[model samples]
Target: MSSPDVPSMTGVHVVVMGVSGSGKSTVAAALAERLTLPFGEGDEFHGERNRALMAAGVPLTDADRAPWLLAVRDWMSAQAPTGSVVACSALRRAYRDVLRGALGDVLFLEVDVPAAVLRARMSARTEHFMPVSLLDSQLATLEPLAADEPGARVDGSASPAAVVEACLAAVRLRCDA
Candidate 1:
């Protein structure tokens, strides 16, 4: 069945989350453009140590990710007045919780894709420090949103435009509700 339509958001913080190569950035950018909200890429918040670890094909531990998540949370909290869209892996429940605590009206937009699709995307992508080797670990660490989680899931297999549309629809619905 097709996904349900979502209403538009007035002032909300949208967190686009998924493993690497799941098109989080592309979808988040489009959603930001559509909503006219400021956008922040979670990668940009990564500490130098974390960047080096990922660049060396090492997966980050929860400890390694905590500071980064905190940075993103702080950024979100700071942007509360204007609203924002942030692209973050948010692979674990704790990480997501941290963000939620900081940004009270937080909403997650999860981009779901198969391992093979993610691998292919990672292989084809360039200029990103995250390597394909880390994908497996990322998948392992990912804590998908539970049924009661405040978010919408979108198929990452679709075109970027389609994914963006789905996210926008979901955000709108949440806002209207």
Candidate 2:
């Protein structure tokens, strides 16, 4: 920790990002639990229109996503003093920029998974509104974390436990790793 009074995780915003069905929510929630931070489910920020579009297998455009990103950004800002772990698709660099704009140094944890695996996961899932048909759109729109971005990437193909372990390591900002 930077100071005796502060927790090491203080003000550390980690956005777990990936395409639909890539396990962003699972990894992020577990990471938050491990770090004892609040967790935000990105999908919950989606407007009714956005949800409807994804449910219909339609890809969301930048214009369509602007408000939703702002909402997520605002939520992060609200938790600024405490820090948070949020799961967001963050499919494009622009989307991530919105998040970073809210807090100057938000960390992004990109979860990478194969398209086939994403398809299988989306198909097997019964809860999410995102459809398997939209997987291609998400895959095509995904932009890996940029070199200048403050973040880390992990293989989402790993078990949920392994994914959480990897995320926790990154969120700690350890020097040894």
Among all candidates shown, the one with the greatest lDDT:
1
**Residue 177 in candidate 2, Cα distance off native in Å:** 9.4
Error of 1 at 156 (Å): 0.8
- Candidate 2 differs from the real structure by a C-alpha RMSD in angstroms, to one decimal, of 2.9
lDDT of 2 by residue, 106-163 (tens): 8899999998899999899998898898888888899899988889889899999998
For model 1, residues 52-106, the per-residue Cα lDDT tens digits are 9999998888899989999999999888877889999998888989999765589
Candidate 1: which pairs clash? Answer: 6-169, 6-173, 7-172, 7-173, 8-172
TM-score, every prediction: 0.93, 0.92
Candidate 1 segments whose C-alpha is farther than 4 A from its true place: 1-11
The alpha-carbon deviation from the true structure for residue 137 of candidate 2, after best TM-score superposition, in angstroms, is: 0.4
What global local distance difference test value does model 2 have? 0.86
C-alpha lDDT score of every prediction, in listed order: 0.88, 0.86
